[model samples]
Target: MSPDIVTDPSRAKRLKAATHAAHDRLDKSIMRLEPFSSIDRYALFLAVQHGFHQDVDALYDDPALDGLLPDLKHRRRLDKIAQDLADLGRTAPAAGSKPVLAGDLPTALGWLYVAEGSNLGAAFLLKEAGKLGLSEDCGARHLAGSPEGRGLHWRIFTTALDAVPLTQEEEARVIAGARAAFMRVQFLADAVFIPSPSD
Candidate 1:
């Protein structure tokens, strides 16, 4: 996890602990791809973001979820990612088989947790994008910081996430969903950023 992220003693902390290993693996995999190596490489990275966000796009607007996380609607970044892709002169790849979380709000929250938590690390990513001549208004819109800023934005999100009541079974499913979300990104990263033979 980014040192900037503070996971309090709540469901968010539990998730941070449970998903730590998977999260580390995903980060290492992405770093190995070196998505910041160049503008082209970053475009491939955006494609991966586009694909993963596209999979979870519906969750942002889900009425049930919005009731729990009131700021949910403004958090959707798929369109921003699409804009980034367009700025780079690339189109979104065809969707893959998305994770099946429909009608399963607990599981869906887990997936949403992984997606939203990523923004915490976007501060570093946004700087790297700058090296490639991409800014919030240009090719890196998806990585732009929220007006509330990263730390406060994340705190607000995790606060709401921790407040949602869950049965024991649902809590277990939430952990599983978060892990699955990480694995899904790993799969997409592999597909979108094919490694050279030497890698």
Candidate 2:
């Protein structure tokens, strides 16, 4: 069964703070890491916003670096990553065991985890793990999610089931964190839609 997210208040507060801090830090760091071109910035934003979608693709598209990740090589890597994620999503439960949720992963704040196509599963997985206090192979690595390339950084928790088999405590934290991150991404999307006076 899914953990109830509403009753507890503390988890709600902590997740809000953590996600906001993450969003803010990502924004500032991206600006420092890339040129001011619109495409560069947007590419970076997508890495953060649609993290589960095209991080590897964006990295593969980089050109100025010269042989760093040539076009053909980049495409191949992205294709492989996508295929792996898809395989993970379609994997069946072990014999005599049933799925914990209807889908491979639960939808959080209307954002379904997109495996085999993006790094979103990694993001959600990281967040969920934090709530459960589990350890991960990557040990909270950032999973890139940036325009320049895929990168890893230490995150809070690990383990895919950390988000799953959640306790009442963990559930509330996941919901709050998911909601806040969702709102932040939505705001970023809306900002992209706004027309400037120069336009």
Candidate 3:
């Protein structure tokens, strides 16, 4: 094992490192969607977000995770997404398939990492949403930055994730789960009407 994994193996750090390719897939996928071009596409973006969150919403209730990050439930954004859709005078759009997650704890944390880590990206997305005439109080509530901010919240989650012990094989599962989570989001991005701005 590398000294880093042996001495201070942070799941968060490792997840970020190991899942770079999957993470890039999600990034490239989102960029193909020019959500800022119009309000409709932006709303569709919100629906995509809702769909992804809804599928994995139950993870927060997992007893094993609760023992570690009891406040895991607090990170749910389905209700917020619903509220944003309501603000737009729309309802939840149908999503694609449910995400296939790992049933084990260490593996599940990998999924959670992808889910919770998304808020950090939302800090930037929220700004882009603003350019489309949306705001936290209205159609972009789900994209709004948290009062506590993404950095602090992510730190809390990563700290909890690293605190858990895992075998190297288990760590492999966790990394795979994170990659799967990203792949699921990329799949969701496919069903939408991805648009581009007129240059």
Of 1 and 2, the candidate ranking higher by lDDT: 1
lDDT against the true structure, each candidate: 0.88, 0.34, 0.79
TM-scores for the candidates: 0.91, 0.26, 0.87
Question: What is the alpha-carbon lDDT for the whole of candidate 2?
Answer: 0.34
What does candidate 2's lDDT look like per residue over 1-199, in tens digits? Answer: 4445433424324444645655456445544544123433423333333333332233223332212212322322333333333332322112221211213122231122112112433455445434533223332233324344332211212212133344555455455535544554444444434436776
Q: For candidate 1, what is the lDDT?
A: 0.88
lDDT of 1 by residue, 1-199 (tens): 4444433439998999999999999999999999999988998999899889988998987888999896899999999999999998998777777645557998898899999999989999999999988899999998988897999999999989987777677888889999989998999899878866887
Off by over 4 Å in 2: 1-6, 9-12, 34-166, 172-199
Q: For model 3, how does the per-residue alpha-carbon lDDT over 24-88 read when each residue is reduced to its tens digit?
A: 87887787788678888877787778888887777887877888884888888889999998888
Mark the 10 consecutive residues where model 2 has the least summed lDDT: 152-161
RMSD in Å for all candidates: 5.9, 19.7, 4.4
Top of the candidates by lDDT = 1
